[model samples]
Target: MGEENLLPNKQIVLKNYLQGCPKETDFELRTTKVSTEIPHGSKGVLLKNLYLACDPYICHLMRPRGLSILSSHGFIVPGSVVRGYGVAKVIKSGYEELKEGEYVWGITSWEDFSWNFYPQQLLIKINITHDVPLSYYAGILGMSGLAAYVGWNEICCPKQGEIVYVSSGAGGVGHLVGQFAKMMGCYVVGSASTNQKVDLLKTELGFDDAFNYKQGDLRSKLNKYFPKGIDIYFDNVGGEMLDEVMLKMNINGRIAASGMISQYNLKEPQGIHNLFSLIEKRLSVRGFMVLDYKEKYPEYAEWAVKKLQEKKLVYVEDVITGLENVVSAFVGIYHGLNIGKRIVVVAEE
Candidate 1:
């Protein structure tokens, strides 16, 4: 095929819907020719992916049929390509709003090349000059970052001196939540699975304090960390951690339910047996999806980007190179194998 007539190709496909934890073998890297020409009157652009986000939400898509899907979030159909947020550059654009060579972050199919797509449907044009790395737009400055902003600002609504605890504190969403709480002048405590993660949370990410949840005495540890009782709990791990946090929640406390990674792998999610505490403590627990807060993206992005420039924001990511390793990188997230945002670099900028 000639340059103007060449087909866009080179993609990763899901071998099948995963039944248990997704493994690297579930995806097959292959090439397929796709038309480079934008269909007549179509408002879309073609892009080459630079960075692809490997989020826990992708794990929800891997579940076998008949198992409870995570919140009706769509999964990768068998033989179809996996999809997620990514940073890409416009290679060809029939759409006036997107120009060639513009950097953007948005929904993208997992591939080296994407055919014509409505980039604006889920995409945001990005500036590459911000102090943060461009890949931050895929995580901290993008979806996962927005997840933290909404969960903290709209849902948790912290105040100065409030005690806030975040589970999985060193992760894509968790790390930001703890830091945002600190920015709001709250007492932030995070629980990580490892000592190194705990250190990153406390020292690098600016958590007021942190502990390794994989170690001893969760309830007692939280109690020891927050002697005054927690005013807000950002529940990411769920299950027993949520239960344990309830034991330490103060009256009128709030819980923002973001994720439940612990239960994602189990046939039956652990039940929370502490509802009685909610009544006695007058606590409120709410679950939120970032899509519900899209109107705030511009405001959040502006503020977050400012923080990044001021050195008040920290972005961390675990990156694995090559499209071939995308499957392994995604699966690693489930085992808490990555720090900060998990990204698969499929191609160079």
Candidate 2:
């Protein structure tokens, strides 16, 4: 290929449908190429990826079809490039809405370059006027942030003096949910699997209280800390945590169902033992995907930026450099190794 015609691309590909927890061997790095220019009259743009998100949903989608974890289109067929969310810089474009040098974030691949055919619909341009980092667009300002906003504003609106609890409290979405609960003047508590993440929730993210779920006497600890009972539960890690939370929910409590990282890879998912409590407490549980709440993005983006400027919002991320670390980083999320959002830096902004 001529120097002006194309560029080399490095892509992460799935060799087969994933089973159990994803391993480094489940994926392979392959080299390809992307066109340096969109064909004449085509509404396409070429992009160089900056940041990529490692979310549990991606892990769920990699499973065998019957075991696929999704309520919508989110699966990865074997032999295709693994799809992910990322921030990218435009290199060439024929789309009126996209221009060279502008940044965008949305559905991207775990690759160095992307030939985006629907940039106008699939991409949102980064605000040149804002001081927010490009990486945040893949997380705190992207689907994860929007999800937290919806979980609080639409799903579970906590009131002053009410008790709020979050499972997976230090994850990409859970940490933000806990913080948003605090912003609403509620008493917030979070449950993480490690003491390091527990400390992060209590100190860095401003949760009123936090605990390690893997520790001794979980029921006793939840009782001692949330003596009055939990009013709202933002669920991220499901399975046994949800069971315990259900048993401790106060009357009229709400549960914002996000994901079940603990149950994603299981051949057989665990069942909650306390369904009777839902009826007895008259509780409300709402589950939603990011796209289900797209109407709130503008409002959330504006509110989040204002909070960031006023020093009221804290955005935490465990950013790893290089695509080589993507597998370990993604697998680490299930092992509770990240303190906040897990991002892979495929390239510099």
Candidate 3:
């Protein structure tokens, strides 16, 4: 190499196993040196991370916490860098398919510079031909988009004029799920934690109905909105909301079991009392993990991008500037502070 490629990389390290809900203090920003060199005979890539996608699931890896949100995954190493989905630029790579300067989005560390040693599949490169912002790959064009697609279309196949309800209606995945359901000719309703989000759902996102779930009794609200039972339920906050929806589901209804953010922070996750309704209603409650659908990612991305381009679909994002704000941006999701996808812009590529 003609020049030395040492650079200071600022990263967020877990201070310790998070005891409860995560706080800014739970993570500490530390700087490390990165050499923009793909080690001899090693298959790894050096990345200049531009954006970090923050979501409720990232909070589950903290060990000082509750029920296993994702089974068998070990806790994050306290003094080590934590990883999540994000957008990055390849600074150097030994991998054949990934050339330097290519943009990619996948599981990346909470750092300004990340050395990804995983397979090309985990560090999948983005298709840069789209005219959208590069940061879009960190969110609507990333895993969140796939999750919304699989849960909304793949799992809960909606029929024209069927009723669909989504919890956490203003959330990263929930927001898009509602839109996709509506596009398919389904009459969709969403539940948000605040009035502002509820309004956006009805006005901007084109949901047929939206209500502040915190403002009124859920059961009564469902009765008011759906005189008949719901035909499809896209569950994002799956605790009390799931229980209520169970009672208001039509026979043979479909419930797409997405993330249960309401239960992620609890040591003991809440149980649904009306599971018998699942039996009586003969409902099909299905859950999906986005990683399992990677093979179809290209197809889904193309279709979703076309939807956005043609103005058939719309999205919202809560972008916080600076890598230093990564921890706070993540914790904000559980509080329902973000209206849509929560993203942390770490640096410019």
Regions more than 4 Å wrong, model 2:
1-3, 66-74
Q: Report, for every candidate in turn, its global Cα lDDT versus the true structure.
A: 0.85, 0.86, 0.86
Give the higher-TM-score candidate: 1 or 2. Answer: 2
Give the per-residue lDDT of model 3 (tens digit) for 188-225. Answer: 99989899999999999999999988887888998998
- Model 3 scores a C-alpha lDDT of 0.86
Model 1 scores worst on lDDT over the 10 consecutive residues at: 64-73
Candidate 2 achieves a global lDDT of 0.86
Sort all candidates by TM-score, best to worst.
Answer: 2, 3, 1
Candidate 2: TM-score? 0.96
- lDDT by residue (135-164, candidate 2, tens digit) is 999899998999888988888867888899
lDDT of 3 at 160: 88
- The CA lDDT at 100 in model 1 is 93
TM-scores for the candidates:
0.93, 0.96, 0.95
The candidate, 1 or 3, that scores higher on lDDT is 3
